[model samples]
Target chain A: MTSETPAALAKAAERPRPALSMSTGRAGDRIFAGLSRGSGLVILAIMAAIAVFLVWKAIPALQDDKANFLTSQEWNPDGAPAKFGIAQLVFGTLMTSVLALVMAVPVAVGIALFITYYAPRRLAGVMAYLVDLLAAVPSIVYGLWGLNFLVTKMTGVSGFLNSYFGWIPLFGGSETGGRTILTAAIVLAIMILPIISAITREVFVQVPHAHVEAALALGATRWEMIRMSVLPFGRSGMVSAAMLGLGRALGETIAVAMVLSTTAGIDWHILKDGGNTFAANIANTFAMSGPTGRSALIASGLVLFVITLLVNVGARAVVARRKEFS
Target chain B: MAKRIEVSGLHAYYGGTHAIEDISMTIEPRSVTAFIGPSGCGKSTFLRTLNRMHEVIPGARVEGKVMLDDEDLYDSSVDPVAVRRVVGMVFQRPNPFPTMSIYDNVAAGLKLNGVRGKRRLDEIVEESLRGANLWNEVKDRLGKPGAGLSGGQQQRLCIARAIAVQPQVLLMDEPCSALDPISTLAIEDLIGKLKSQYTIVIVTHNMQQAARVSDRTAFFNIAGTGKPGKLIEIDDTSKIFTNPEQKGTEDYITGRFG
Candidate 1:
């Protein structure tokens, strides 16, 4: 239609344009909706892309027969013919993660409870901040610190245990054995402690004041209120917090490798010698690997990916059940 | 049957802010007492003091004597938990431990006091729900979540949970404020029934509620900013509403000033 035609003129009226004076919803609201939809779509697309890429890269390793991607323990990517299995890597990974969680959960929950329930108000904020700072420290820094400082401390502790509980298979190793799975687990605990503790402290603080007051008014001691009101209210947070920390521990590489001094073998004694986690096995052996070795490493990585997926799924389930903090 | 709660020259503060000024009143056993005033007039604060709940807040402190049956509640040797076991509180909002079910909510108080035999717990839960007038509504659904109840029902559930231990006194802070008229009436009727067996203390912004439920009415008012609250007048509910001695109490009850 010609620019001056009635059809063109009506089309001009039909064109979308921003109205300055006439208003229904404020302009800010429309902009907010636009921003939210844009960001949401971007996150969705990114996550989908990552999942596709991970699955694509993982297929080759899974398909390899000698890789024993799911079952066997022999992870010799550098064997004469380059046949490898994930069995030992899986065992090592589970051992290290469970050990780390065993050490961290109680301490994390206790620290959180102490800060929220018992610490003097004037001091509690500063203590909470210090715990938060732990999470800010980089994973590499934790590795360095674990090697330089924590290893020696754990060595001393390992010595005492060797003397006392050495009869047990796990602790039978020489106390001087500095690099072992036990050491790696303790290092992992320190690394993830802040994550669990911070979430738990926040959860404890979010317990409704009225619930707390109701408990208190009923003649509950401070500890009783914590047991009755605070802990139960924060239970889901505590569980998810632990799962979040587990996610971190699952894929950690640099720190675990730095401290573990891992060897390629299947040994039930965690304190005897260093055993490699899947992430550490990949990081430690990737440079020296041939094609089969790399394939085997990729196979282990696939397993690590599955573990993290399961952990994150569990965390989401817990988060769904938890009440809002406010 | 005539237990007494005596508060004498009581003062309480949050940090440096005076929340409750010097106030004294005696509550009779099985009698309903209402603390009424404008918002921030220390009614809730004073109610908290009776149960030693004020101390639970960080920086909250109280001074002076709070005697129940002539025993000082704030005495250093007194156990706060023991004190709470005897006096229970219902909050402004219904909080039924969202994680727990209807059965568990009533049993919580008993469990806290170390009463754990299953038969005994079941008996107490049934009796408490009946006392709160909520047994019939939730009897079949004791396994359901307490949070899923209607507002009034949730509140009665909370009340049942509190009274499960058979406390000597009950403290309520605006127990009906969040409820509708029908729910409010139900709770009010429950309160009347409750006071015959347990001493009851309540705080409310609605003057008509104070008039309707309380056996004795206390009129409290703010004296000055940053100062403790003062008791303007306290007497029989009818006398306080119709023939108060203080002009401030009359002005307040008449809707001239709050």
Candidate 2:
């Protein structure tokens, strides 16, 4: 019986195995792989196409301009001798986005921490739902609200800052109306808050259960546990979230256009009226612009696109560097 | 600074579900007491209750009394954080803070207790790492992340982190269950060495492990699914393994049934 069993086992081992094939033998597998690879290439193609189009459309206005397209503060592209530059637009975009980031990141992180750690379970669920719902509110609606409600209410805030903090160069302007860069920045901050908090909350929630328990087991108070484990683990995530918020603020058009009374020059005094970002300028001028003006706006749009891309790439690099340690 | 543990008429629950019921035991100072049970027996839950870690889970609660050398651990005046400081825990899996260096991992608990000065932290971190039998392997790369270590090394690093706070008791909830055989042997040896200075309670599924390390052994069992687990018997390790007074303990020891 043993000899017969050994012969049968040897015969079984010699049989050709159909399951060992690793190739994509089935039609479904080949089609799915091809489709996924095609989708990835399509994204790359679309990105390149947009860049090519922007550069192609922008060159004519840039060549015809009398002033330096980069350094000149003038924005009269349709004149007999066209004049335009991105300096003022660049300054406004950076100032408002950076200001918004400074104002929003702390409050967003605070709200995230409170929802994840401090709130009761039911309240946390409700709060998280509300924050997500806030993100779904349309940008145009935010613009309308900023123009009618927020701008009117912000005069007192602008006055207070001018009264007490006017010594700081950024606040030294004499403008007392609500339609200043500060008001626009405040609206931008509010616009980006939901997204920043949502992402920060997800990062906080993804902090490993073991790490949290390790802190608590070591006798750490709740606050200490958060500081030691939660914050350090979520640091890179929070930075990326803030970077994403910055990207949104930089490109935000309608709200900034509605809030800020436009001017074509750089102003460090954020409390003063009159600043124009690339997106706001494009939105405000696109309808009235002649062909040269439209091309000029497209040129500025290209720069804004590049800046946002750089910001996102920088965020990815920061996240990747921290990934090694974690 | 080992302290005796006296648990009396203890019951634990998870929301509406009773987990462990009426477990009473005395664990001597400077010795190891092991809890041996099948899956779903609530042995881990009972061990967590010793340090108030059970209540950390939302809706989980405990009833009755646990005294650490005449001090009621569950007393309203006693903060759970303070209780945990005195009774440190090692989990089933290795959990060194992934963001921290090996040196910082060992110093973590000490930092929480407000220990300052670089020299002092360095001294204690080295001492604790040596105590966990991990100093030699990691001494040269102390600045490296703790998560970069092997599973066994990470577990020992967690042990070092726990003991750095100078706890009176150490509770291990199946500390070596996730480890390879070699790592398991190393942890068992470390557990044997640790019992000279800290009261230790270990929950293990391995019967031979229970026989090898424990001074006293406990047998826990449940009647059925959804039923609260109960302690079957507790006695000297030799007696429990050879001639248990309870029928269920004997059946479990002899592999008749869980």
Candidate 3:
């Protein structure tokens, strides 16, 4: 009987069984799968349509341009020759965003660490809510606040930088008014701070408990534990967070328009006035420009879109590479 | 060098929930002492209290007097970080810092404690890995990420990391529970070797492991669910296995009940 049992089990194992269907499963499962797939395709379709639209509109403005579209510092798309370029706008966008990133990343990481490791439970919850609340505040309100309040307060700070650090080229030049690239960058830093910290806090919170205990058991102090465990684990996350903040800073429109005094050329002296970003330029000029000028604005918009896309892609690559080891 | 541990009237709690009742015992220097208990009986918690690691959990606190030879571990003047340096730990699951290389994982404690000089770090890393019985297997790939190692190797790497700082006491909370039988045997052998240099306190649910490795054995048990865990008896490994004084301890060792 025992010998026959093996053969019987073998026969049972070899017998054909009904296949478990996915698409042909219950009606609910099929409907859910279709809805999810349709949602994903809709997003892809919308992204493609936007890209096509930007390219179609930008081509006409490029054809009508008299000056080098990429290199020229002038913006005169409505002129008889319709000469215009994005050099100044590109420079401003990159400069302000990079500056904001440099200023905000350290503070954001500090705040994240504070929220995760240092604060009392009640205080941590309140602080986290407040940071998220900062992100939800309207950009126009920030623009108005920057123009009416923050700009007035930045004069002393700019003066301090210009005087003490005047030998440094970026901090040189005696432009008196507070409406400068530095001020705009500061505003952008404040605007992006919450988002960077929020994402960084989430990443730090997800650091494996075992890894943390390992560090602590190694006799690591609070700061050392953060340096050894938290920071290394969250390195890629912090990079992505900074990149996201950079994207926001680059595309910020009404705030930069309201805060910055736009000009036609790049200004190396960030402490001085006169820098304009692509979004700020477009927001300030789209209504005043003719049809060709509107196309020119869209062309600049296309450049901004491409730059943001590249930044996001680069961030994803960095995160994906680090995910293997982590 | 190993230091004797004297724990007296230790009681631990997490928030309002009492986890472990008053427990007292002396752990000898340069010997293996195993804590055996059922699940949720606080054998692990009692081990953590030896190194003041029990309080790492939020809302978890301990009231106890743990003395490492002449020094009281919970003294107001003693920093927990300093205590941990003197008393290291190895967890159940291997946790070699995922971002660090094997060499860095071993040298992490030394580097963080401000020990400079590449030659010194290299010497210590080699010594620690050799002490943990993992040097030959991992010597060629010291620069590789620690997480890439097999499970048993990773646990040994964690042991190497724990010993790199030359802690006086080593706490193992079910260190071999996650390994295969062969890996478990390897760790058991390593534990036998390690006890000669450091005071080893291990918590295990496996009775055979306790009998094989420990010089003395402690059994902890709870009255029932929601009741605090208590140390039922502690004695030489031979006596505890052959003839325990407490009925509960005998019943436990005989596998009559948990």
Candidate 4:
């Protein structure tokens, strides 16, 4: 009987089963797949349309402007010559966003680690919810709070830094007004904190138990474990989170405009109270200007759009470069 | 430099659930001891309690007296990190720090112990790979990521990493359960050679494997679901297989019952 069972089992194994061909996908399945693909293409089409419209509107402003658009610092689109440039606006946008990222990333990562590794289980949930609440606050509300409360409160601190560190180029100028680029960057930093921390917290939580145990088994202390296993594994994640925060800081309109009192030119020192980003400039001037002035604002908006795109693409390239081991 | 271990009145718990109860044994230096039990029988838990690795889980605690030569391992003053440095571990599935190269994986523990010179690290990394019997296949490619190795080679790399620090005791929790038969035989052979240098304690489910590699065998069993695991018998491998003192051990060995 055992011999017969072996022979029968061999015969059964040798028999071919039915082939699973593409014909198995019914018409309904194909239709659903097509719908998903169509949706993705539609999003691309919308993005292309917006790009085309921005470029169309920006060309007339470039033709009318007498000043060099790339190098000139003055923006007087309402004048007969319609002189304008993006140099100062570019500097303001990059400086404010970069400064905010420098201040926010370290604190965000610290808060994320504390919530993930150190806090008690019940308290961690509460802390995470509080961070989410920070993200939920309206930008207008933050603008009001920054303009009324934080700028006034920061006057003493700004004056103190200018006095002690004035020899440093970035902190060189005297602080005549409290509403400066420094205060605007502080407000932007506070705005982006929740997003970076929330994303970083999720990334830290996803570190594998096996890797953690591997570090612990190697006799690593708690801080050493974080440095060895947690940080390296979450490097790309933290970078992406920081990039997302940067994207927000770059395009924030009401908050930067409400806090920063713009002057005519760019200053090397951030404590001197005069800077204007593309988003804030458009919001502050678009409604009251003539057609050429409005087109100039759109031209600046186009520049901001391109800068953000380059930043995101650069971040992706960085992530791709480090993908070999991960 | 292996040291003997004496464990008495060891009780382990997860939250309020008692996992192992009243376990007592003396593990000899420079020998292989095997822990065999069914699933959920707490053999793995008992193995973890030896090196204090079990307490990493939240709410997991132990009440015990574990002496390494003269010092109590469970004393409040004895740092768990320090204990782990003295007692190394190899896990069931090979984990070789996915982001590190093969050389870095082996040298990681040594570096943590403050060995900084390049020449010394090179000497120790080569020595450890040779000890794990993985030198010939991987010496030319030490710069490669550790995760790129085959399963058997990766497991050996983990062994090399664990022994790089030259700890006194080596704890393995089902080290061969994830390998094929040929890889299993290779690891079994390596264990035989390693017994001369390190005190080895291993938890396994395969009775034949335990009989082959271990000098002494410990059998654990539970009365019913949710009951704490208890040690049924511990004796020489030959005696445990041929003439057990307990009926529970006899039944488990003979495939009569778990």
Residue A201 displacement (Å), model 4 = 1.5
lDDT of 4: 0.92
lDDT of 1 by residue, A151-181 (tens): 8787777778888888988777654466778
Instruction: Estimate, for each residue in B49-126, the C-alpha lDDT of model 2 and write its tens digit.
Output: 999999989999999999999999999999999999999999999999888999999999998889999999999999
Local distance difference test values of all predictions, in order: 0.85, 0.93, 0.93, 0.92
Task: Please provide, for model 4 over B1-258, each residue's C-alpha lDDT reduced to its tens digit, 9 standing for 90 to 100.
Answer: 999999999999999999999999999999999999788889999999888999999899999899999999999999999999999999999988988999999999998899999999999999999999999999999999999998889999999999999999999999999999988898899999999999999999899999999999999999999999999889999999999999999999999994
lDDT by residue for model 3 (B1-258), tens: 899999999999989989999999999999999999889999998888888888889999999799999999989999999999999999999999998999999999998778899999999999999998999999999999999999999999999999999999999999998999999998999999998899999999899999999999999999999999999999999999999999999998898994
TM-score of 1: 0.88
Per-residue lDDT over A1-326 for candidate 4, one digit per residue giving the tens place of the 0 to 100 score: 86799899999999987677746658989899999999999999998998999999999999999999998999999899899999999999989999999999999999999998889889999999999999999999989999999888877777888888888888887554668888899999999999999989998999989888888998999888898789989898899889989999999999999999987778878887789999999999989999999999999999999988887887777668667755
TM-score of chain A of 4: 0.91
Compare the candidates by DockQ and give the number of the best one: 2
True contacts kept of each: 0.79, 0.90, 0.90, 0.74
| Poorly placed runs, candidate 3 (over 4 Å) | A1-25
DockQ of each: 0.61, 0.82, 0.80, 0.75
Question: Ten-residue segment with the worst summed lDDT in candidate 3 chain B?
Answer: B46-55
Candidate 1's residue-wise lDDT over B85-140, tens digit each? 88888999998887789999888888888898989888999999999999999999
